[model samples]
Structure formats: C-alpha cells, structure tokens
Target chain A: MRFEVKNASFSYKNDRKIFEDVNFSVDSGDIVAILGPNGAGKTTLLKCILGILKLESGEALLDGKDVRRMQERELFKRVSYVPQAKNTTAAYTVRDTVLIGLAAELSVFKSPGEAEEERVRKVLKELNIEHLIDKKCNKISGGELQMVLIARALISEPEVLILDEPESNLDFRNQLIVLDTLTKLSKRGIACIFNTHYPSHALQRANKAIILSEGHTVCGDCESTITAEAIEKAFNVKATINEYSDGGNTIKTVVPISVIR
Target chain B: MVEKKSIKILRTVLLIILPIATAIIALMIGRIAISPKDVFLILTGQGDMVETVSRMTVISFRLPRIILALFVGAGLSVAGCAFQGLFANPLATPDTLGVASGASFGAAVAILLGFNAIPVQISSFIFGILAVVLTVLCGRGKGKGMTMIILSGIMIGSLFSALISFVKYVADAESQLPAITYWLMGSLASTDYKSLIVGVPPILIGILILFILRWRMNLLPLTEDEIKSSGTNVLALRAATVLAATAITAASVSMCGQVGWIGLLVPHMVRMRLGSNFKTVVPASISIGAVFLIIVDTVARSLTASEIPISILTAIIGAPFFIYLMRRGGSFR
Candidate 1:
C-alpha cells in the first residue's frame, strides 16, 4: 500500500500560509518520522494527509485513489489516525474507548454485537492490555493511555497508521516502548508516519524521516535525511550527529549543545 | 467478571422495576388517598361501586399528570445525556442552550397577550427551538468547539431570561402575574389528557432517535479532530444530535415550565453508578429520571393541600444528592 501527498498547500484565516508546498509518501512496511520545531505546521501537515483538514491546493492520495473522494468507511478501513493523547475528560473504560475505532465498520443505529466484542477483546489481548479492559481511562497513566490509544487505532487493522507526537508525554522507558511498538507494527507491513520532538527517536526507529521546516520539507531515508546539518537548518540549533554500536547494531544519536542564530 | 455480570443483570432489572414501583407509589399517595389494593383494582378496571369516585380521581386527574411527568422527565434526561456527551462537558444539560429560558419567555408573552393553553404551548415550543437556533448560529464557524457553543448558549440564555423578567414587570398585577409566575416556577397540576396526546409523541420520537444513535453518541466526547479522523461526518452527526436533543427539550419545556435538575443530574448519576457507556446511560437515565420526577411530583402534591412547584422540589432534592456525590467523588470529572 502507498500513501502520497503531492504539492499539498494550506493556509489559515487571513491567508496565513502554514504549508507552502509539501510532498511525501510512504509505502507499506516503511516508517516515516516527521521532525520540526514547535508551531512548524507538523500537525497541520498530518491533518492534511489524514483528510481531516482540506488542502488549499493539490491533493493526498491513498493507494492511487484520491483520499478526498473515497467514502468514509472505505477510507477509514485503509488508514487509521492516532491523535496526541490529550487527557480526555470523558470517563470511558478502556474497552469502550477502543470499540469506537471500529465505528465505521459497524452499521449505524446498531450496537457492536458479540462478534465485534470478541474482536475488541482479541486486539486488547494482543496489545497485552487485556487486564485493563474494564478500567476507566481517567485512572490510567499517560504511558498506559498511549498504549490504549495505539490499540484503538489498530482495532481497524488499517494499512497506514498516522500518529501525532505519540511519545510526547511518555517517560524514557515508555518512549522506548512506543517506538518499539511502532517498529513491530511496521514489520507487520503497516506503513507508519509519526511526528516527534525527539530526533534521536526518529534516528533510532524511523526508516524514513521527513523534516518540515520554514514551510519547506525534505524527505529521504533516515540516515542521510536527519544529519547534523539538516537538524541545524531546521531548528537553528548547533548539534552533532554521533554514531555508536549497541548490541551489534549501529545507532545514530543527535546531541544539541547550543542555539545558533 | 462474574460480579460484573450480576451487577449488569441487577441494573437491567432495576431499570425495569423502578419506574413501575414509583408510578404505583405515586398513584397511592395523591390528595384522595386510596389503598394500594384499591389502586391496583381500580387501575385493572375490576373495582366496583365505592371505588368509582376513586377510579375517576385516579384516571382523570392523577394518571395524566403522572404520564406527562414521566415523559417530560425521560425526554429531558435523554437530551441532557446527549448534550453532555456532545460537548464532552459533564455539566451540560438540555437547557444549556437556553431552551428553558426561551420557553419561559414565550409562555410569559402568551400570558400577557391573553393566549389560551394550547396557543401558549405552541408559542413556548417555537421560542424554545428559536433560542437554540440563535445559539448555534452565534457559535457557528469552520470548526466550532465546546467553549464557543457553551459561551453562545450562555449569551442567548441570559437574553431570554432578561426578556422573561421584562414580561413579568409588565404583566397584570393579580391574575395574569400569579399565573405566569406559577407556570414559570413549574408544576404538573395543569397537565391533562389533551396535553399528553400532543406532547408525548415528539418526546418519544426524540428519545428513540437518541437511543438508536447511542453508540455513535459516545464519540461526542472525543476532540473534534479525533472525531473527524474516525471517518464519520462530524458536523452532520453533531447537527443530528443537537436536533434530537433540542426536540425533546423544547417539547418538555413547553408542556411543563422549567423543570430543572433531572436533565443535568440523572445522566451524571447514571454514569457515576453504572459507568459512562451511552448505550447504558441513555436508557438508565430515562428510567431513573422518570422515577425521580414521579417521586418528586408525589411529594409535591402530598406535602401540602396547595401543590408545590416541581422546580423547587427538584432543587431541594437534587442539590443535596449532588453534594453527596461530590463528597463521594464519583465519576464526575
């Protein structure tokens, strides 16, 4: 499966241009990490790709079909989005929250039946969160909430998973856990695109990195795309890209030392 | 799991039995007291001679009030639940969009203009819907959020409330003023079979639509961007929910003046006790709200020879119960 954006442009009220011209694509089994500074329109770009935000010009396509023209059910069956884990005030249980992912599949005016419930159960079990099936979401920790959100997104079994800053609120261990989950999902042939503040995470987990900076974007394989020069260009920070060996695998990490004009 | 199963079964049973029990107790405790045995026989159409007066009293007076109260309570509760879910605010209610205040303003105008009962109800219903429409229009934008909707509702609600106060200021000193004030305070004393025939259908249809959309309603608490990503038409869904909720609220408020608390309180109580599942919350709110208002109405009628306004009793009961809930720190947040 392939999802591509071609010359997509967007502007807000008063003609404030967010994305001047952006282009990127992801094939099945590829993970794309979006890196940028705050307010760089990273989330806006994700929304444009998800078809939640209408483009001012150009289009996004999913598997050679215009995403804007696809029916909601058909489109949702192929692409799932996991939004940033804002603490939802609604006290839905873990099962209740996850079941909503399959809403497009369920017929309107009908509740999920036994078969659908069984599927939800199986997905939660597969995610190793079956024990939290009945727990109210407000009671869960941030890391657990992220896992629950991922489980919700996966319940649809989509070909493409789009996540926005999936590890934003997570601690070090939990960040690793989210990255590990994305890698495993990528290995299963679900194309994953996630934006992150941590470039080290992008270096460690993403096969493809797209750096969105100054209304322009650069997309390529992770190693060449996320260099110290690119990091300096995008964030205006003096940084170094270092290589280290961990358990017989080469790992690249970005270290920021100072701000540059 | 086993305990949950039993609790689910118990809740189902209570949902069925509570309203019936409250209705029976209500029938027995009215102004002309009849024994429960007599009440049962009279209701079943099997009582003879001495029960005839009692039977007429039950059917003509008490029964219509009970039926109207039950439906109005159910309608308001379901609308409240839908609103709470739609705005993702636990404090939202059927009247949050100014339907009650607008309906009161309409009723006050009707009274000042010397319109009769049916015309007054029609006026109230139209104005109630108008208030909500004004709120929606004021809040309309590319992607209006919870804060905008709530803020517009407050604006429209206050406007109508001020209009109501103006109507009262100009109303005749004795007859019209007392009548308008009493109606504004709320009571089921004037409900009859005719009002029930007119009022029940809209409320029932609204409730049915909301129940059918209960699972979809659960999505309302999610962020707007998240809802859009879920692949449903978020704007269309939100409009339908608002329409359904407004229909019930307008109908209920037109028939009975400003009966408060049931709409705001019942849904939270249901969520607190039974979990925040709209599939369960909608139906549970209906049953519990019906019972609560029926009991409150019974108390209103029996506590004094002159009937008490239902709005007062609802606050009297609802405030303390809600405080108790706060102390317990139930699902309210």
Candidate 2:
C-alpha cells in the first residue's frame, strides 16, 4: 500500500512556516529515515503525517484515501505512532500500557478480553519483551521502555509505523538493537519511518531518507541522498562519508570532521 | 500471567463483606447498645420482640445514618479516584476542581438567608456544579493542560471559600454562626432516610457510569497526545468523567455537609491494595471508603455525648495513614 505526503505545509501561530511544500512517500516494505538538526520540523512533519496536526495545505493519503477524512479509529488502525520516551510517573504495568494501544480495536463498553490479552502477549514476545509483562513501567530502563513502547505500537498491527527518535536516550548497543528491530519489521512488509539524530543509523538501515532543512525537504534513496554535501547544507557541518563492505552488504557511515558556522 | 485466584477471592470477600459487617457493628455500638440477636431480629422484621426505644433507634437513627455514610464515602472516593486518573496526580481529590468549596459557599448563603434544610441542600448542589462549569470554561483553549485545569480549579475554590468565610462573618453569632461553623466542619448527625432518598440516585448513577468506564479510565494517566492518537477523544472522555464525578460529589456534600479526606485517602488505600487497575480500584474504593467513613462516623457519634464532626475524625485517621504510605516508598508503584 502507498502511504504518501504530498506538498504538505504547516505553520504555527505568528505565521512563520515550520516546513513548506514537504513531500515524500513510502511503499510497503520501505523503511524511511527522517534526519535533521534540532528545530528542523522533523517531529512536526511526523505529527502532520499522523493527522495529529492539520496541514496548512496539501494532504497525507493512506491507501489512496485522505487521512484527514478517515475516522480516528480507522486512521489509527492504518497507521501507528510511537512518541519519544519521557519520564512517566504513572504506575501502569507493561501489559496495561500495551493493552491501552488496543483502543482503536476495543469497543467502548468492553475491556480487553482474553483474545486481546493473548494478542498483547504475542506482540510482547515478538518484540522480545515477554519477561517485562508484569513489570511496572516506571521500573524499566530507558531502552526497555522504548522496546515496550514499540510493542505497544505494534499491537495495533498498523501497516505504516511512525516513530519519533526511538533511539534518542539509548546507549550505543541499545540504539543498534532498536534500529535492528525497525529494520526487521520493515522486512516483514510494514513500512517503517523513524526520525534519528544519528545519520549513520539512517545509512545503516533506511532504504530512503528525508532530510528537513531551512523550511524545505530533500527526499531520495539513502545511498545517493544522504551525502556529505547534504549534511553540510542541512546541519552546517563538514562531514566525511565512509563506505565499507560488511560481508554481502555495503555499509555507509557519516563522521562529522568540523563545524561550519 | 498466572491468576492468583486465592488473593482475588480474599480481596473480593473483604470488599463486599467488611462494610456490611462494619455497618452492623456500628448499628449495635451507639450509646444505647442493642444485642446482636436483637439487631438481627429487628433487621429481619422481628422487631415486635424489641423494646420501643431500641427499635426506634435502630430503624430511625442508626440505619439512615449508616446508609448515608456509605453513600457519601463511596461517592467521594470514587470521584477522587477518577479525578486522580484524569489529572495524573495522586494527591488530587474531589475538591481539586472546586466543587466541594462551592457547595459549602452555597450552603452558607442558604443558611444566611434562613433557608430550611432541603433548600440548603438544593442550593449547595446547584452551586457545586456551577463551580465546575466555571472552571471548565476558564480552562478552555490552547493551554488546556491538566495543570491549567487544576490551577483554574484552585482559583475557583479560593473564590468560593472566601465567600463562605464572608457569609460566616455576617451570620448571627448565637445561633446561625454556630450552625454554619458546624456544617463547614462537616457532620452526618442530621442524616435521615429523607436525605438519603434525595442523595442516593445521583450518586448511584454516577458511580455506575464510572464503573462501566473503569477500564477506559486507565488511559487517563497516559500522555494526552498518546490517548488522542489511540482513537479516544481525550477532551470528551475527560469532560464526561468530570461531570459524572461532580454529580456525586455535589450530591454527597449537599446531603451530609463537607466530609473531607475520604476522597483523597480512600483511593490511595485502594491503589495500595488493588494495584491501580480502575476496574478493581473503582469498586474497591467504593467499599473501602464506605467502611472507613462508617467507622469514622461511628466514632464521631459514640466518642462524645454531643456528636463530633466527621471531617475531624477522618482527618485524624487519614493524615497519619497517608504519611505511613508515603514513608513506605514502594507503595506508590
């Protein structure tokens, strides 16, 4: 299925545009990475695509239907969103938190039944977080929490998965683990899109990259699009791009050499 | 997950049976003690064997007071649990949105005007609801965060409480002043079947709605953005919950004056035992809260020749227990 954003534009009050004429799309099995410096409207673009924010112009379509016109339940059933981790003091168990993600499927009068519970357990196992089912959310570490959040999102079985900075607070090994999980999900035919501050991560996993810079967007295949020139232009950094063959696949990494104004 | 059937059964038994047992014990222990056999006989329609005064006491005084206490406790505690979830704040209670203070001001105003008991109740109920409506309106728009709703409630509560103080100042010192002061401190001394008849419907209906929505209420403690993204309308759900909770809080305050701490303490007690699942927590709050207030009300009546205010006894019990819970540290999780 085609999930596309066409020339979407948005602005907050006082009218300076956060992003203008931003356009991109990801088909089934495509994993897209969104990369930009801070305040680059990366999160804003994701919000717009998720229908959380109304676009000033243009539209996001899921399977050729305008997302804005779809009911909230229908939209969420098609697309799932994972927000960045924050310190939550609520004392929900990991199972309780994940069960909440089944809201789109649950009728208002019904609590999560045995089938729903079984589905949640299966999703937790899929994300390798089965052991955390009974653990309180506040007791979990950051990486574990992110995995739990992803499991929460995945329980919806959304065709398109959108995540905001899934690896932001994680250590290096944890970051690789999360990124690897996203890549695995994409290979299973769920189109995955996530924002990352680390360009090297996008180079490793994303088939396509969209970089937001100066109220505009650059989108293309990751191999050609996320270049040293693009990083210099988007982030004002002098960076070197290195390539290596890791067995059967070519790996790309971006190393910042110096800061330009 | 393996189900702990024994623990679940024990909790259910304690919740349902404890309150009724407490109510019965309370009925027997007042100044004029009745034997358990006689109390049972009277309750079972065998009052013909009992003395006149004892029969009258059991039916007219103790029964209604106990029933009203149960309703007030359950109403306030359930509302407190819902509001805490809505605001994601453990310390939040029924008065967090100004309903209790507003009801007090209305009762004070009615008292100042020499209104009868029924008029005072109606006035209090109206004003309590009005206060929440005002708070909701004041908190509308871009800054519609939980903190803003709470701040607006505080502002409205302060306003109503100040008005209550002003009414008290102008009241007749010999009679009306003392009555108003007693009411403000809270009591169920005057509660009878009539007041229960007036108060029970709204409280029952409100609690029923909350029970049906208990599982959904679990979502209230999460981020608003996450809630909305999950296909639930956060504003609509919160507004409906607040309205239902407020109806019961208003009804309780009007019936029995302003009993405090049941709202705040009972929910914490329930969470400590039930582990924060609203499905269990809401119902548990009802029974536990009912038992707690009945016990406290029993002391308020039996401890002194003249009845002591319920709020005093509840605060006396609640504050220490709350401190103990906080000290326990892991209790919150």
Candidate 3:
C-alpha cells in the first residue's frame, strides 16, 4: 500500500496558508519519520493526511484513492492515527479503552465479539501490557499509556499508522521500546509515519525522513539526506556530525557542548 | 476478586433497598398515619381498611406524583450524565445548553398569549424541543471546540432568560402572572396521570437511548483523531447524543416545570460512588436520581399544609452537597 500526499496545502482561515505544495509518499513496510522544530506544521501535515484538516490545494490519497472521498470508517480501516497525548482522564479499564478501537469495524449497535476479544488480548500481550489490562487507564504511567494507545491503534490492523510525538513523554527505555516496536511493525509490512523532535530515533528507525520547516518540505530521503547541515539549518542550531567506526552517524550540538565562563 | 464481587453485589443490593426505604418513609410522613399494611393493601388493590378518601389520596394522587418524581428525577440525572459525557466536561448539564431556559421561555410565551387551556404539559413539551433546536443552532460552530459550544449555550440561555423575563412582565397580572411565577418556581402540585402519560414516553425513550450509547459516550472525552481511529464518527455521534439528552431534559422540565438539582447533582453523586463508566453511572444516576427527587417532592408536599415548590427543596439540599463535593475536590480538574 502507498500513502501519497500530492502538493498538499492547508490554511487555517483561508487567509494564512500554513503549508503550500507539501508532497510525500510512504510505501508499505516503510518507517517514515517527519522531523521539524516547533510551528513547522508537522502536526498540520499529519491532520491533512488524516482528513481532520482540509487540504487547500492538493489531495492526500490512499492506494490511488482520494482520502476525502473515502468514508471515515473505510479510511480508518486502512490508516490508524495516534494523536498527541491527551490530558483527559477516565476511569475506563485498559481493556475497555483498547476495545474501543474495534468501533469502526463493529456495527453501531453491536459489541465486540469473541474473536475481537481474543485479538484484543493478543495485542495487549504484544505491547507487554497484559498485566495492565484490568487497571484504570488514568492510573497508568505515561509510557504504559502510550503503549496502550499504540495497542489500541493496532487493534484495527491498519496498514498505515501515523503517530504525532509518540516518544514525547517516554523515558529512555520506553522510547527504545517504541522504536523497536515500530521497526518490528514495519518488518510485518505496516507503514509507520511518526513525527518527532528526536533525530537519533529517526536515524535508527526510519527508512525515510521528511523534514518540514516554516510550513514547507525542505528535504526528503533516507539517513544520508539528513545531514548535520540540514539539521542545524532546520532547527537553527549548530551541530557536528560524527561518523562511528561501525558506519553509523550521530549529530551532536557543538555549541551546547561547552559552558560559558 | 471475591471481595470486589461482593462489594458490587452490595452496591446493587443497596440500590434496590434504598428506593423502597425512601418510598416507605414518604408514605409514612405527612398527616396521614396510613400503616404499612394498609399502604400495601392500597398498592395491591385490596383491603376494606382502604377508605374511599384515603384510597383516592394514596392511589390516585400521591402515587402518580411519586411516580412522576421518580421518572423526572431519573430522566434529568441520566440526561445530565449524558450531557457531561457528550461535552466531556463535568460542568455540562441540561442548563449548560439553555434547554431549561429555552423551554421556560417557550412555555411562558404560550401562557402569556392566552393559550392557558392548551395544557401547560403540552406547552412545555413543544417548547422544550423548540428550545433544544434553537440552542443547537445558536451554539453550533464550524469545527469549534467544547469551550465554544458551552459559551454559545450560555449566550443563548441568557437571551432566552431575558425573553422569559420580558414575557413575565407583560403577562396579564390577574391570571397569568401567578401561573408563570408558580411554573418558574417548579412544582409537582399539578402533577396527574394525564401529564405523566404525555411526559414519560419521551423521557423513557431518551434514557434508553443514553443507556444504549453509554459506552460510546465514554469515547467523547478523547481527541477527535483518537475517536475516529477507534472507528466512531465523533461529530455525528456527539450531535446525536446531545440531541437525545436535550430532548429528555426539555420534556422533563416542561412536564414538571423547572426541577433543578436532580439533573446537575445526581450524576455527581453516582460518579462519587461508582466512578464514571456510563454503564454504572447511567443506571445508578437513574435509580438514585429517581429516589432522591421522589423523596424530596414527598417532603415538599408533606412538610407544609400546601405543596411547596420542588426546586426550593432541591436547592436547599443540592447546593450544600454541590459545595461540599467541590470543596472535597470531587469536581477538581
């Protein structure tokens, strides 16, 4: 499956164009990371793709079909989105929260059946959250909550998964867990598009990277295209790229390395 | 696990027992010293001791009033719970959308226009639906957030309230003014089988709808994208739910005048006990709300020689509990 955005442009009030002529595509089995600083319209771009926000000029298509024309349920069947972490709290059990993912596939009046329950259990186990299944969602740690959210998203068995800042609130171990999970998901032929501020995670997990700056796509490629110059230019910070003996690259901010006297 | 199950069982047992207890107490109070046996006989349609006057008072008058109280209480509370879930805010209630005020204005206008014999019951039902439609139209925004909807409701409510006040001023001083005042204060004094028959259907239908959609209502607090990804149409579902809730609320208010507190407070009481799952919250609210209002209305009628307004009793009880809940951080964000 290919998720394509062709010359997509969006504006808030039909006056201020947030992004103009943004283009990208993600193939099945591809892990694409969108990297940008704050206010770069990375979130907006994701919304445009999800059809939550309207496209001003171009279209976002899934498998050569216009996303806008696809019914919400049909579009959701193919693409699942994990939004930014919400502060809303509910006393719903983790199982209940995850079961809601079956809403699109289930009829309006029917509850999840035996097969769906088994699938939910499997997904919870895969996310290493089987122990937390009966616990209140509001009572979980942030990382666990994120995993629960991801597990919920996976319940739909969507081909394309878009996450906005999945790693934002995670600790180091959880971040690695999420990255590794995305890698495993990609290997299983699921296309994962995640927006992140962390470039190293992108370098480790993403087969392709698209960098947005000032509401425009500045660069697009695999790891080689995301150079220290591009990172420094996009973030407006001075950085030095170090190549390891194992043929890996790390970009570190040189200016922040030394303290002022 | 056994203990938890026992606790749930205990809660369910208590829900059943509490309403019966309240009804017994309600029957025992007031100048009538009807024994439990006679009360039972009257209820079961037997016993020579059940005199014509007492039978009429108990079977026809008090029984219907109590039943109406139960229905109105349950309806308002469930509607409140649904509204809270729909708006994804604790503060959201029937009044939040100005349904009460809108209905009141509609009813008031009908009264002032010499539509007295048209039956206050029918006037309220029509106005209640009208108010909800008007509120929805006024409060609607193009992809706006919950805050915008709430603000729009407040503005519309104020507008309707002002209109109601103006109507009150122009109402015929000799006949309509007093009726309008009594209606505004809210009473079960005029409640009868006729009004109950008209009001109960919509209220029951609305509550049933909320019961069916309770789980889906749980998803409203989540982000739009999250809800969509979960395979639900957030906008359509929310609109439908709000409409259903508002319809019930309007019908209840029009039927019973403006019985406050039950809609706003009963859900909070339920939440305090059972947590916020609509599965437990909706049913608990219905039960507790019905019982609470039934008891209060019983007290209102019994405590005075003449019937007192239900709102006065509700406010007296509900406001202090609301304050206590707020202070105790039950309402803290």
DockQ, all models: 0.61, 0.53, 0.43
What residue runs in model 3 are displaced by over 4 Å at the alpha carbon?
A111-120, A214-220, A244-261, B1-29, B47-49, B116-159, B325-333
TM-score of each: 0.93, 0.93, 0.87
**Per-candidate local distance difference test:** 0.83, 0.85, 0.77
Q: Write the per-residue lDDT of candidate 1 for residues B1-333, one digit (tens) a residue.
A: 679778888989989898988897798887789888888887787867446778888888888989888888888898889887876766567556777788778867987999876677678778877987887788778656555776787789999989998898898877878877887788888988988887788789888999899988888888887777778889888888877887787677767788987887888878778788898999999998888788888889899989889899888866776556546643423
lDDT agreement of model 3 with the native? 0.77
Q: Across residues A78-123, which tens digit of lDDT does each residue of candidate 1 receive?
A: 8999888874545889988899898878877888766777877998
Which candidate tops lDDT?
2
Q: Quick one: ranking by DockQ, best first?
A: 1, 2, 3
Per-residue lDDT of candidate 2, residues B1-333 (tens digit): 346767777889988999999999899989999999989999999999999899999999999999988888888999998888876766557676788898888878987998876777678878887997887688667885546776888799999999988998999999999888887788888878877877788889888889888899988877766887888888888977887888788778777777877888999877876688787899899998889889889988999999988888888877787557546643222
lDDT of 2 at A41: 88
Clashing pairs in 2: none
Which residue pairs does candidate 3 place in steric collision?
A104-B231
Best by DockQ: 1
Tens digits of per-residue lDDT, candidate 3, A141-226, equal 88888888888889989999999999987899988888888999999999999999888777767878888876445546756757
